[model samples]
Target: MRYKGFVIFTLFLFNIITIKPKAIDEKDSLYIDNCKRDLLVLMMAYSDEIRDIEVSEDNYIYLVLNNNKKIIYDDKKEKNKNAKILDADIQDTLEDIYPLDSINSVLEGMDPGRGRSYTFLNSIYGGNQNEIEKNLDFFSTYCGNIMFNKKAKAGEALKNALNEAKELADKDNRVNNYIFPISGSYNYRVIQDTGRLSPHAYGIAIDLNRNDSDYWKWVDKSKGSKRIEEYPKELVKVFENNGFIWGGKWEHFDILHFEYRPEIILKSKFFGDTSKSNNKKWYEGAPLNDEIENIINIINSKL
Candidate 1:
Protein backbone atom coordinates (compact mmCIF):
# COMPACT_ATOMS: atom_id res chain seq x y z
CA MET A 1 0.00 0.00 0.00
CA ARG A 2 1.26 3.53 -0.80
CA TYR A 3 0.01 4.28 2.73
CA LYS A 4 3.61 4.04 3.92
CA GLY A 5 3.99 7.70 2.89
CA PHE A 6 0.65 9.16 3.96
CA VAL A 7 1.30 12.80 3.04
CA ILE A 8 -1.95 13.30 1.09
CA PHE A 9 -2.51 15.17 -2.17
CA THR A 10 -5.07 17.84 -3.06
CA LEU A 11 -7.24 17.61 -6.20
CA PHE A 12 -7.94 20.69 -8.31
CA LEU A 13 -10.88 20.90 -10.66
CA PHE A 14 -10.32 20.87 -14.43
CA ASN A 15 -8.47 24.15 -13.77
CA ILE A 16 -5.49 24.59 -11.43
CA ILE A 17 -7.49 27.20 -9.50
CA THR A 18 -10.13 26.36 -6.84
CA ILE A 19 -13.63 25.56 -8.06
CA LYS A 20 -16.95 26.82 -6.73
CA PRO A 21 -19.28 24.54 -4.75
CA LYS A 22 -21.55 22.43 -6.98
CA ALA A 23 -24.19 21.83 -4.29
CA ILE A 24 -27.26 24.09 -3.95
CA ASP A 25 -26.51 25.33 -0.41
CA GLU A 26 -23.75 25.34 2.18
CA LYS A 27 -25.47 22.42 3.94
CA ASP A 28 -25.48 20.38 0.76
CA SER A 29 -21.86 21.33 0.18
CA LEU A 30 -20.86 19.89 3.56
CA TYR A 31 -22.87 16.73 2.90
CA ILE A 32 -21.27 16.12 -0.49
CA ASP A 33 -17.83 16.86 0.94
CA ASN A 34 -18.38 14.27 3.66
CA CYS A 35 -19.53 11.66 1.13
CA LYS A 36 -16.45 12.25 -0.99
CA ARG A 37 -14.16 12.05 2.04
CA ASP A 38 -15.72 8.83 3.34
CA LEU A 39 -15.60 7.25 -0.12
CA LEU A 40 -11.97 8.22 -0.52
CA VAL A 41 -10.91 6.64 2.78
CA LEU A 42 -12.93 3.46 2.16
CA MET A 43 -11.18 2.96 -1.16
CA MET A 44 -7.81 3.69 0.43
CA ALA A 45 -8.23 1.29 3.34
CA TYR A 46 -9.84 -1.44 1.24
CA SER A 47 -7.96 -0.68 -1.97
CA ASP A 48 -8.17 -4.23 -3.30
CA GLU A 49 -11.82 -5.01 -2.47
CA ILE A 50 -13.74 -1.75 -3.02
CA ARG A 51 -13.12 -1.67 -6.76
CA ASP A 52 -14.80 1.61 -7.77
CA ILE A 53 -17.49 4.20 -7.14
CA GLU A 54 -20.58 5.12 -9.16
CA VAL A 55 -23.09 7.92 -9.53
CA SER A 56 -26.56 6.67 -10.37
CA GLU A 57 -28.67 8.15 -13.15
CA ASP A 58 -30.64 9.96 -10.45
CA ASN A 59 -27.45 11.43 -8.88
CA TYR A 60 -27.28 9.08 -5.90
CA ILE A 61 -23.74 7.87 -5.10
CA TYR A 62 -22.62 4.29 -4.58
CA LEU A 63 -19.50 2.31 -3.77
CA VAL A 64 -19.12 -0.62 -6.17
CA LEU A 65 -17.42 -3.70 -4.79
CA ASN A 66 -15.19 -6.21 -6.58
CA ASN A 67 -18.16 -8.62 -6.62
CA ASN A 68 -20.19 -6.01 -8.60
CA LYS A 69 -22.35 -5.00 -5.63
CA LYS A 70 -23.31 -1.39 -5.02
CA ILE A 71 -23.77 0.11 -1.53
CA ILE A 72 -25.50 3.46 -1.17
CA TYR A 73 -23.56 6.47 0.09
CA ASP A 74 -26.42 8.24 1.88
CA ASP A 75 -30.09 7.32 2.18
CA LYS A 76 -30.93 10.96 3.18
CA LYS A 77 -33.46 9.68 5.71
CA GLU A 78 -34.61 11.33 8.91
CA LYS A 79 -33.37 8.94 11.57
CA ASN A 80 -33.15 9.07 15.32
CA LYS A 81 -29.88 7.98 16.94
CA ASN A 82 -31.18 4.47 17.64
CA ALA A 83 -32.51 4.13 14.10
CA LYS A 84 -29.09 5.05 12.76
CA ILE A 85 -27.49 2.05 14.47
CA LEU A 86 -30.34 -0.43 13.93
CA ASP A 87 -30.47 0.32 10.19
CA ALA A 88 -27.27 1.99 9.13
CA ASP A 89 -26.28 3.08 5.64
CA ILE A 90 -22.67 3.90 4.80
CA GLN A 91 -23.46 7.51 5.72
CA ASP A 92 -24.88 6.72 9.16
CA THR A 93 -22.08 4.29 9.86
CA LEU A 94 -19.43 7.00 9.51
CA GLU A 95 -21.48 9.95 10.79
CA ASP A 96 -19.83 9.97 14.18
CA ILE A 97 -16.19 11.07 13.94
CA TYR A 98 -13.75 8.83 15.77
CA PRO A 99 -11.12 10.62 17.89
CA LEU A 100 -7.64 9.51 16.87
CA ASP A 101 -5.83 11.38 19.62
CA SER A 102 -5.68 9.83 23.06
CA ILE A 103 -8.69 10.71 25.19
CA ASN A 104 -8.86 10.12 28.93
CA SER A 105 -12.62 10.47 29.30
CA VAL A 106 -15.33 8.40 27.65
CA LEU A 107 -17.31 10.12 24.89
CA GLU A 108 -20.74 11.43 25.80
CA GLY A 109 -23.54 9.67 23.87
CA MET A 110 -21.21 9.25 20.90
CA ASP A 111 -20.03 5.81 19.81
CA PRO A 112 -18.02 6.21 16.64
CA GLY A 113 -17.51 3.05 14.64
CA ARG A 114 -20.31 1.42 16.67
CA GLY A 115 -22.98 1.81 14.02
CA ARG A 116 -21.63 -0.33 11.19
CA SER A 117 -22.75 -0.91 7.62
CA TYR A 118 -23.33 -4.66 7.34
CA THR A 119 -23.32 -4.44 3.55
CA PHE A 120 -19.88 -2.84 3.64
CA LEU A 121 -18.65 -5.29 6.28
CA ASN A 122 -20.00 -8.34 4.46
CA SER A 123 -18.68 -7.15 1.13
CA ILE A 124 -15.09 -6.99 2.39
CA TYR A 125 -15.10 -9.68 5.07
CA GLY A 126 -17.79 -12.31 4.36
CA GLY A 127 -21.52 -12.48 3.80
CA ASN A 128 -22.45 -14.87 6.65
CA GLN A 129 -21.16 -17.02 9.49
CA ASN A 130 -20.33 -19.99 7.26
CA GLU A 131 -18.53 -17.87 4.70
CA ILE A 132 -16.70 -15.94 7.44
CA GLU A 133 -15.64 -19.15 9.17
CA LYS A 134 -13.98 -20.30 5.98
CA ASN A 135 -11.72 -17.22 6.23
CA LEU A 136 -10.99 -17.57 9.98
CA ASP A 137 -7.55 -18.60 11.16
CA PHE A 138 -5.87 -18.81 14.56
CA PHE A 139 -3.09 -16.32 15.14
CA SER A 140 -0.77 -16.24 18.14
CA THR A 141 -1.29 -12.86 19.79
CA TYR A 142 0.79 -11.77 22.76
CA CYS A 143 -2.43 -11.69 24.72
CA GLY A 144 -3.23 -15.27 23.64
CA ASN A 145 -4.02 -17.40 20.62
CA ILE A 146 -7.31 -16.39 19.02
CA MET A 147 -9.18 -16.69 15.74
CA PHE A 148 -9.25 -13.76 13.29
CA ASN A 149 -10.44 -13.37 9.72
CA LYS A 150 -7.51 -13.68 7.36
CA LYS A 151 -9.20 -11.43 4.81
CA ALA A 152 -8.29 -7.74 4.33
CA LYS A 153 -5.21 -8.25 6.53
CA ALA A 154 -7.27 -8.18 9.72
CA GLY A 155 -5.44 -11.14 11.25
CA GLU A 156 -2.10 -9.78 10.13
CA ALA A 157 -2.78 -6.38 11.66
CA LEU A 158 -3.85 -7.98 14.96
CA LYS A 159 -0.68 -10.03 15.14
CA ASN A 160 1.46 -6.99 14.32
CA ALA A 161 -0.22 -4.86 17.01
CA LEU A 162 0.22 -7.51 19.68
CA ASN A 163 3.76 -8.22 18.59
CA GLU A 164 4.57 -4.56 19.23
CA ALA A 165 2.61 -4.72 22.48
CA LYS A 166 4.60 -7.78 23.54
CA GLU A 167 7.77 -5.85 22.82
CA LEU A 168 6.46 -3.00 25.00
CA ALA A 169 5.64 -5.54 27.73
CA ASP A 170 9.32 -6.36 28.08
CA LYS A 171 10.15 -2.93 29.57
CA ASP A 172 6.87 -2.21 31.29
CA ASN A 173 5.40 -4.94 33.50
CA ARG A 174 2.19 -2.92 33.76
CA VAL A 175 1.53 -3.50 30.06
CA ASN A 176 1.73 -7.25 30.61
CA ASN A 177 -0.86 -7.15 33.40
CA TYR A 178 -3.23 -5.19 31.20
CA ILE A 179 -3.01 -7.38 28.10
CA PHE A 180 -2.25 -10.86 29.35
CA PRO A 181 -5.14 -13.35 29.50
CA ILE A 182 -6.88 -11.71 26.56
CA SER A 183 -10.59 -12.21 27.06
CA GLY A 184 -11.34 -13.56 23.58
CA SER A 185 -11.65 -13.00 19.82
CA TYR A 186 -13.67 -14.32 16.82
CA ASN A 187 -16.97 -15.22 18.52
CA TYR A 188 -19.70 -15.42 15.86
CA ARG A 189 -22.41 -13.69 17.87
CA VAL A 190 -24.58 -10.60 17.63
CA ILE A 191 -23.82 -7.65 19.88
CA GLN A 192 -25.71 -7.77 23.17
CA ASP A 193 -29.32 -6.48 22.86
CA THR A 194 -28.85 -5.70 19.16
CA GLY A 195 -30.04 -7.33 15.94
CA ARG A 196 -26.94 -6.26 14.03
CA LEU A 197 -23.98 -8.56 13.68
CA SER A 198 -20.96 -7.63 15.81
CA PRO A 199 -17.51 -7.17 14.29
CA HIS A 200 -16.63 -10.30 16.23
CA ALA A 201 -19.14 -12.15 14.05
CA TYR A 202 -16.82 -11.48 11.13
CA GLY A 203 -13.75 -12.41 13.23
CA ILE A 204 -12.39 -8.85 13.24
CA ALA A 205 -12.72 -7.70 16.87
CA ILE A 206 -10.51 -8.67 19.82
CA ASP A 207 -11.05 -8.32 23.58
CA LEU A 208 -8.08 -7.72 25.77
CA ASN A 209 -7.84 -8.76 29.46
CA ARG A 210 -11.18 -7.88 31.01
CA ASN A 211 -12.03 -5.80 34.00
CA ASP A 212 -15.44 -5.45 35.70
CA SER A 213 -15.37 -1.74 34.96
CA ASP A 214 -14.43 -2.35 31.32
CA TYR A 215 -18.07 -2.36 30.19
CA TRP A 216 -20.51 0.58 30.27
CA LYS A 217 -23.83 -1.16 30.97
CA TRP A 218 -22.23 -3.40 33.56
CA VAL A 219 -21.03 -0.47 35.65
CA ASP A 220 -21.43 3.27 35.16
CA LYS A 221 -19.65 6.21 33.48
CA SER A 222 -17.80 7.06 36.69
CA LYS A 223 -16.23 3.63 36.80
CA GLY A 224 -15.64 3.59 33.05
CA SER A 225 -13.79 6.90 33.26
CA LYS A 226 -11.63 5.60 36.07
CA ARG A 227 -10.69 2.55 34.01
CA ILE A 228 -9.96 4.73 31.03
CA GLU A 229 -7.70 6.90 33.15
CA GLU A 230 -5.75 4.00 34.60
CA TYR A 231 -5.39 2.31 31.23
CA PRO A 232 -1.96 2.52 29.57
CA LYS A 233 -1.93 5.02 26.72
CA GLU A 234 0.96 3.35 24.89
CA LEU A 235 -0.98 0.12 24.61
CA VAL A 236 -3.89 2.00 23.09
CA LYS A 237 -1.52 3.79 20.70
CA VAL A 238 -0.11 0.52 19.42
CA PHE A 239 -3.59 -0.82 18.66
CA GLU A 240 -4.69 2.37 16.91
CA ASN A 241 -1.51 2.46 14.83
CA ASN A 242 -2.42 -1.02 13.58
CA GLY A 243 -6.01 -0.04 12.50
CA PHE A 244 -8.16 -1.01 15.52
CA ILE A 245 -10.70 1.28 17.20
CA TRP A 246 -10.90 1.02 20.97
CA GLY A 247 -14.40 0.63 22.36
CA GLY A 248 -13.10 2.27 25.52
CA LYS A 249 -13.29 5.55 23.61
CA TRP A 250 -17.02 5.14 23.11
CA GLU A 251 -19.73 6.44 25.44
CA HIS A 252 -21.09 2.92 25.59
CA PHE A 253 -17.57 1.92 26.50
CA ASP A 254 -16.16 -1.59 26.11
CA ILE A 255 -12.61 -1.12 27.36
CA LEU A 256 -11.45 -4.60 26.40
CA HIS A 257 -12.83 -4.37 22.88
CA PHE A 258 -10.60 -3.40 19.94
CA GLU A 259 -11.95 -3.89 16.43
CA TYR A 260 -10.08 -3.67 13.12
CA ARG A 261 -11.44 -0.60 11.32
CA PRO A 262 -8.82 0.86 9.00
CA GLU A 263 -11.17 3.17 7.09
CA ILE A 264 -12.20 4.95 10.27
CA ILE A 265 -8.60 5.39 11.32
CA LEU A 266 -7.48 6.49 7.89
CA LYS A 267 -10.28 9.07 7.66
CA SER A 268 -9.36 10.63 10.99
CA LYS A 269 -5.66 10.42 10.25
CA PHE A 270 -5.93 12.15 6.88
CA PHE A 271 -9.04 14.28 6.31
CA GLY A 272 -10.43 15.17 9.73
CA ASP A 273 -13.19 17.76 10.20
CA THR A 274 -13.17 19.26 6.73
CA SER A 275 -14.88 22.39 8.02
CA LYS A 276 -11.64 23.42 9.71
CA SER A 277 -9.54 22.58 6.70
CA ASN A 278 -7.87 25.42 4.67
CA ASN A 279 -6.58 23.16 1.92
CA LYS A 280 -7.37 23.66 -1.79
CA LYS A 281 -8.40 20.01 -2.20
CA TRP A 282 -10.70 17.74 -0.20
CA TYR A 283 -8.09 15.00 0.13
CA GLU A 284 -5.44 17.52 1.15
CA GLY A 285 -3.24 15.51 3.48
CA ALA A 286 -3.34 12.09 1.82
CA PRO A 287 -0.11 10.63 0.46
CA LEU A 288 0.06 10.02 -3.27
CA ASN A 289 1.20 7.05 -5.38
CA ASP A 290 0.09 5.27 -8.55
CA GLU A 291 -2.61 3.29 -6.68
CA ILE A 292 -3.87 6.20 -4.55
CA GLU A 293 -3.62 8.59 -7.48
CA ASN A 294 -5.76 6.19 -9.52
CA ILE A 295 -8.39 5.93 -6.76
CA ILE A 296 -8.46 9.72 -6.33
CA ASN A 297 -8.86 10.16 -10.08
CA ILE A 298 -11.82 7.74 -10.11
CA ILE A 299 -13.52 9.63 -7.25
CA ASN A 300 -12.80 12.98 -8.83
CA SER A 301 -14.16 11.84 -12.21
CA LYS A 302 -17.17 9.83 -10.96
CA LEU A 303 -18.29 12.05 -8.08
Candidate 2:
Protein backbone atom coordinates (compact mmCIF):
# COMPACT_ATOMS: atom_id res chain seq x y z
CA MET A 1 0.00 0.00 0.00
CA ARG A 2 2.86 2.38 0.84
CA TYR A 3 4.60 1.59 -2.47
CA LYS A 4 1.34 2.14 -4.40
CA GLY A 5 0.83 5.49 -2.66
CA PHE A 6 4.43 6.47 -3.49
CA VAL A 7 3.88 5.57 -7.17
CA ILE A 8 0.69 7.64 -7.31
CA PHE A 9 2.45 10.65 -5.77
CA THR A 10 5.36 10.28 -8.19
CA LEU A 11 3.03 10.19 -11.18
CA PHE A 12 1.15 13.28 -9.96
CA LEU A 13 4.41 15.17 -9.41
CA PHE A 14 5.74 14.10 -12.80
CA ASN A 15 2.57 15.25 -14.54
CA ILE A 16 2.75 18.60 -12.76
CA ILE A 17 6.42 19.03 -13.67
CA THR A 18 5.91 18.08 -17.33
CA ILE A 19 2.91 20.34 -17.95
CA LYS A 20 3.81 23.52 -19.89
CA PRO A 21 1.95 26.77 -20.29
CA LYS A 22 0.63 27.38 -23.82
CA ALA A 23 3.30 28.93 -26.02
CA ILE A 24 2.56 32.24 -27.71
CA ASP A 25 2.02 31.03 -31.30
CA GLU A 26 3.14 32.89 -34.45
CA LYS A 27 -0.25 34.62 -34.82
CA ASP A 28 -0.19 35.62 -31.16
CA SER A 29 3.47 36.69 -31.40
CA LEU A 30 2.76 38.91 -34.39
CA TYR A 31 -0.44 40.25 -32.94
CA ILE A 32 -1.39 39.90 -29.29
CA ASP A 33 -4.65 37.94 -29.10
CA ASN A 34 -6.49 40.93 -27.66
CA CYS A 35 -5.52 43.08 -30.64
CA LYS A 36 -5.58 40.36 -33.32
CA ARG A 37 -9.29 40.70 -34.02
CA ASP A 38 -9.16 44.45 -34.57
CA LEU A 39 -5.92 44.27 -36.55
CA LEU A 40 -7.00 41.33 -38.68
CA VAL A 41 -10.30 43.01 -39.49
CA LEU A 42 -8.44 46.16 -40.48
CA MET A 43 -6.11 44.19 -42.74
CA MET A 44 -8.64 41.88 -44.36
CA ALA A 45 -11.27 44.57 -44.79
CA TYR A 46 -8.68 46.79 -46.45
CA SER A 47 -6.68 43.91 -47.88
CA ASP A 48 -6.31 45.57 -51.27
CA GLU A 49 -4.58 48.49 -49.63
CA ILE A 50 -2.85 46.84 -46.63
CA ARG A 51 -0.16 44.29 -47.36
CA ASP A 52 0.87 42.80 -44.02
CA ILE A 53 1.22 43.48 -40.31
CA GLU A 54 4.16 42.39 -38.15
CA VAL A 55 5.43 42.63 -34.61
CA SER A 56 9.03 43.37 -33.72
CA GLU A 57 11.08 41.28 -31.25
CA ASP A 58 10.42 44.02 -28.73
CA ASN A 59 6.64 43.78 -29.52
CA TYR A 60 6.12 46.99 -31.47
CA ILE A 61 3.31 46.62 -34.05
CA TYR A 62 3.92 47.56 -37.66
CA LEU A 63 1.24 48.09 -40.28
CA VAL A 64 2.64 47.72 -43.82
CA LEU A 65 0.52 49.20 -46.57
CA ASN A 66 0.43 48.14 -50.22
CA ASN A 67 2.09 51.45 -51.03
CA ASN A 68 5.02 50.24 -48.87
CA LYS A 69 4.28 52.72 -46.13
CA LYS A 70 5.12 51.30 -42.70
CA ILE A 71 3.46 52.61 -39.54
CA ILE A 72 4.59 51.62 -36.06
CA TYR A 73 2.60 51.76 -32.83
CA ASP A 74 4.72 51.74 -29.62
CA ASP A 75 2.62 53.54 -27.05
CA LYS A 76 2.56 51.52 -23.82
CA LYS A 77 0.25 53.21 -21.35
CA GLU A 78 -0.50 50.53 -18.74
CA LYS A 79 1.27 47.38 -17.47
CA ASN A 80 4.40 49.60 -17.27
CA LYS A 81 6.79 47.79 -19.67
CA ASN A 82 4.58 44.70 -20.04
CA ALA A 83 1.91 46.16 -22.33
CA LYS A 84 1.06 43.64 -25.03
CA ILE A 85 -1.15 45.73 -27.33
CA LEU A 86 -0.04 48.64 -29.47
CA ASP A 87 -2.09 51.68 -28.50
CA ALA A 88 -3.58 49.40 -25.83
CA ASP A 89 -5.05 52.41 -24.10
CA ILE A 90 -7.60 53.25 -26.81
CA GLN A 91 -7.90 49.80 -28.32
CA ASP A 92 -9.55 48.49 -25.16
CA THR A 93 -13.22 47.70 -24.65
CA LEU A 94 -13.95 51.33 -23.76
CA GLU A 95 -17.49 51.03 -22.37
CA ASP A 96 -16.02 48.40 -20.04
CA ILE A 97 -13.13 50.73 -19.21
CA TYR A 98 -15.52 53.49 -18.25
CA PRO A 99 -18.82 51.94 -17.30
CA LEU A 100 -21.63 54.32 -18.19
CA ASP A 101 -23.69 52.96 -15.29
CA SER A 102 -21.11 54.13 -12.76
CA ILE A 103 -21.86 57.04 -10.40
CA ASN A 104 -19.52 59.47 -12.20
CA SER A 105 -19.54 58.02 -15.73
CA VAL A 106 -17.37 60.62 -17.44
CA LEU A 107 -13.88 59.27 -16.84
CA GLU A 108 -12.07 62.47 -17.75
CA GLY A 109 -8.45 62.29 -18.98
CA MET A 110 -9.18 58.62 -19.59
CA ASP A 111 -9.99 59.43 -23.19
CA PRO A 112 -9.81 56.07 -24.95
CA GLY A 113 -9.82 57.77 -28.36
CA ARG A 114 -6.90 60.07 -27.59
CA GLY A 115 -4.21 57.46 -28.28
CA ARG A 116 -3.88 58.47 -31.91
CA SER A 117 -1.23 56.72 -34.01
CA TYR A 118 -0.36 59.79 -36.07
CA THR A 119 1.78 57.93 -38.58
CA PHE A 120 -0.75 55.13 -38.98
CA LEU A 121 -3.55 57.67 -39.50
CA ASN A 122 -1.59 59.75 -42.00
CA SER A 123 -0.71 56.60 -43.91
CA ILE A 124 -4.31 55.32 -44.02
CA TYR A 125 -5.97 58.67 -44.54
CA GLY A 126 -3.83 61.20 -46.53
CA GLY A 127 -0.24 62.14 -45.57
CA ASN A 128 -0.24 65.91 -46.09
CA GLN A 129 -2.65 68.85 -46.44
CA ASN A 130 -2.28 68.62 -50.22
CA GLU A 131 -3.00 64.89 -50.30
CA ILE A 132 -5.80 65.26 -47.73
CA GLU A 133 -7.38 68.25 -49.47
CA LYS A 134 -7.96 66.55 -52.82
CA ASN A 135 -9.91 63.70 -51.18
CA LEU A 136 -12.38 65.98 -49.36
CA ASP A 137 -16.05 66.04 -50.41
CA PHE A 138 -18.88 68.16 -49.10
CA PHE A 139 -22.15 66.54 -47.97
CA SER A 140 -25.19 68.63 -47.28
CA THR A 141 -27.03 67.61 -44.11
CA TYR A 142 -29.95 69.42 -42.48
CA CYS A 143 -27.21 70.85 -40.25
CA GLY A 144 -25.19 72.37 -43.12
CA ASN A 145 -22.66 71.54 -45.81
CA ILE A 146 -20.13 69.48 -43.85
CA MET A 147 -16.87 68.78 -45.64
CA PHE A 148 -15.25 65.44 -44.78
CA ASN A 149 -13.04 62.63 -46.09
CA LYS A 150 -15.22 61.14 -48.80
CA LYS A 151 -12.70 58.58 -50.02
CA ALA A 152 -11.78 57.33 -46.55
CA LYS A 153 -15.44 56.23 -45.96
CA ALA A 154 -15.73 58.75 -43.12
CA GLY A 155 -17.99 61.13 -45.01
CA GLU A 156 -20.39 58.36 -45.95
CA ALA A 157 -20.45 56.94 -42.42
CA LEU A 158 -21.26 60.38 -40.99
CA LYS A 159 -23.87 61.00 -43.66
CA ASN A 160 -25.57 57.67 -43.07
CA ALA A 161 -25.56 58.14 -39.29
CA LEU A 162 -26.98 61.64 -39.56
CA ASN A 163 -29.62 60.45 -42.01
CA GLU A 164 -30.67 57.75 -39.56
CA ALA A 165 -30.84 60.42 -36.87
CA LYS A 166 -32.95 62.52 -39.21
CA GLU A 167 -35.29 59.58 -39.72
CA LEU A 168 -35.51 59.27 -35.94
CA ALA A 169 -36.18 63.01 -35.80
CA ASP A 170 -39.05 62.64 -38.24
CA LYS A 171 -40.61 60.34 -35.67
CA ASP A 172 -39.55 62.47 -32.70
CA ASN A 173 -38.61 66.06 -33.55
CA ARG A 174 -36.40 66.28 -30.45
CA VAL A 175 -33.54 64.52 -32.30
CA ASN A 176 -33.22 67.41 -34.74
CA ASN A 177 -32.57 69.84 -31.86
CA TYR A 178 -29.39 67.92 -30.97
CA ILE A 179 -27.70 68.02 -34.42
CA PHE A 180 -28.22 71.31 -36.18
CA PRO A 181 -28.16 74.83 -37.40
CA ILE A 182 -24.61 73.67 -37.72
CA SER A 183 -21.03 73.50 -36.60
CA GLY A 184 -17.97 72.97 -38.77
CA SER A 185 -16.11 70.01 -40.27
CA TYR A 186 -13.14 69.57 -42.64
CA ASN A 187 -10.93 72.33 -41.24
CA TYR A 188 -7.43 72.12 -42.78
CA ARG A 189 -5.27 73.03 -39.80
CA VAL A 190 -3.43 71.85 -36.71
CA ILE A 191 -5.13 71.75 -33.33
CA GLN A 192 -4.75 74.88 -31.26
CA ASP A 193 -1.81 74.69 -28.77
CA THR A 194 -0.51 71.47 -30.32
CA GLY A 195 1.50 70.50 -33.39
CA ARG A 196 -0.73 67.50 -34.07
CA LEU A 197 -3.35 67.82 -36.78
CA SER A 198 -6.96 67.66 -35.69
CA PRO A 199 -9.24 64.93 -37.09
CA HIS A 200 -10.84 67.94 -38.76
CA ALA A 201 -7.68 68.24 -40.84
CA TYR A 202 -8.47 64.77 -42.19
CA GLY A 203 -12.11 65.84 -42.56
CA ILE A 204 -13.19 63.06 -40.21
CA ALA A 205 -14.59 65.02 -37.27
CA ILE A 206 -17.52 67.36 -36.72
CA ASP A 207 -18.66 69.90 -34.16
CA LEU A 208 -22.43 69.98 -33.50
CA ASN A 209 -24.71 72.35 -31.61
CA ARG A 210 -21.84 74.59 -30.57
CA ASN A 211 -24.10 76.81 -28.52
CA ASP A 212 -24.92 73.96 -26.13
CA SER A 213 -21.38 72.57 -26.25
CA ASP A 214 -19.04 72.99 -23.31
CA TYR A 215 -15.29 73.09 -23.91
CA TRP A 216 -12.91 72.48 -20.99
CA LYS A 217 -10.34 75.03 -22.17
CA TRP A 218 -13.04 77.67 -22.40
CA VAL A 219 -13.95 77.11 -18.75
CA ASP A 220 -12.15 78.81 -15.88
CA LYS A 221 -10.07 76.22 -14.02
CA SER A 222 -11.27 77.52 -10.65
CA LYS A 223 -14.95 77.00 -11.54
CA GLY A 224 -14.86 73.18 -11.21
CA SER A 225 -17.55 72.78 -13.90
CA LYS A 226 -15.84 70.57 -16.46
CA ARG A 227 -18.32 67.73 -15.87
CA ILE A 228 -21.56 69.03 -17.27
CA GLU A 229 -24.17 66.51 -18.47
CA GLU A 230 -25.48 68.45 -21.44
CA TYR A 231 -24.87 66.45 -24.64
CA PRO A 232 -27.94 64.27 -25.16
CA LYS A 233 -27.11 60.65 -24.44
CA GLU A 234 -29.24 59.56 -27.40
CA LEU A 235 -27.33 61.75 -29.86
CA VAL A 236 -24.01 60.60 -28.43
CA LYS A 237 -25.09 56.96 -28.73
CA VAL A 238 -26.13 57.40 -32.36
CA PHE A 239 -22.74 58.87 -33.25
CA GLU A 240 -20.83 56.28 -31.25
CA ASN A 241 -22.74 53.42 -32.86
CA ASN A 242 -21.68 54.85 -36.21
CA GLY A 243 -17.90 54.81 -35.44
CA PHE A 244 -17.46 58.22 -33.86
CA ILE A 245 -15.92 59.02 -30.47
CA TRP A 246 -17.42 61.86 -28.45
CA GLY A 247 -15.05 64.48 -27.03
CA GLY A 248 -17.44 64.93 -24.09
CA LYS A 249 -15.91 61.85 -22.49
CA TRP A 250 -12.44 63.41 -22.26
CA GLU A 251 -11.01 65.19 -19.21
CA HIS A 252 -10.34 68.05 -21.56
CA PHE A 253 -13.94 67.63 -22.66
CA ASP A 254 -15.19 69.29 -25.83
CA ILE A 255 -18.90 68.54 -25.66
CA LEU A 256 -19.57 69.55 -29.24
CA HIS A 257 -17.11 67.24 -30.99
CA PHE A 258 -17.45 63.79 -32.53
CA GLU A 259 -14.68 62.10 -34.51
CA TYR A 260 -14.84 58.98 -36.66
CA ARG A 261 -12.83 56.16 -35.01
CA PRO A 262 -14.37 52.80 -35.88
CA GLU A 263 -11.77 50.79 -33.95
CA ILE A 264 -12.90 52.19 -30.64
CA ILE A 265 -16.51 51.13 -31.31
CA LEU A 266 -15.28 47.68 -32.44
CA LYS A 267 -13.15 47.13 -29.34
CA SER A 268 -15.86 48.42 -27.02
CA LYS A 269 -18.42 46.07 -28.56
CA PHE A 270 -15.92 43.19 -28.44
CA PHE A 271 -15.65 43.62 -24.68
CA GLY A 272 -19.36 44.21 -24.27
CA ASP A 273 -19.91 40.88 -26.04
CA THR A 274 -17.56 38.92 -23.76
CA SER A 275 -17.76 37.64 -20.21
CA LYS A 276 -18.46 40.36 -17.71
CA SER A 277 -16.91 38.33 -14.86
CA ASN A 278 -13.44 38.53 -16.38
CA ASN A 279 -12.69 42.16 -15.75
CA LYS A 280 -8.98 41.75 -16.34
CA LYS A 281 -6.76 44.52 -17.70
CA TRP A 282 -6.88 45.28 -21.45
CA TYR A 283 -3.76 43.28 -22.32
CA GLU A 284 -5.20 40.06 -20.91
CA GLY A 285 -7.12 38.14 -23.56
CA ALA A 286 -10.76 37.35 -23.02
CA PRO A 287 -11.29 33.69 -22.12
CA LEU A 288 -14.08 32.86 -24.59
CA ASN A 289 -14.75 35.29 -27.46
CA ASP A 290 -16.22 34.47 -30.89
CA GLU A 291 -18.30 37.58 -31.52
CA ILE A 292 -15.60 40.10 -32.50
CA GLU A 293 -14.98 38.12 -35.65
CA ASN A 294 -18.68 38.08 -36.47
CA ILE A 295 -18.88 41.78 -35.66
CA ILE A 296 -15.96 42.36 -37.99
CA ASN A 297 -17.70 40.26 -40.62
CA ILE A 298 -20.78 42.44 -40.38
CA ILE A 299 -18.65 45.58 -40.50
CA ASN A 300 -16.73 44.22 -43.50
CA SER A 301 -19.98 43.46 -45.31
CA LYS A 302 -21.04 47.05 -44.71
CA LEU A 303 -17.72 48.48 -45.85
On lDDT, the leading prediction is 1
Candidate 1: what lDDT? Answer: 0.85
Model 2 accuracy (lDDT, Cα): 0.62
lDDT of 1 by residue, 204-228 (tens): 9998889999998899899899999
Alpha carbon lDDT of each predicted model: 0.85, 0.62
How many pairs of residues collide in each model? Answer: 5, 1
lDDT of 2 by residue, 93-155 (tens): 322242222122345346556546566667777889998888888887766677888754788
lDDT of 2 at 103: 21
For model 1, the stretches where C-alpha displacement exceeds 4 angstroms are 1-23
Off by over 4 Å in 2: 1-31, 44-48, 56-59, 75-105, 220-228, 273-303
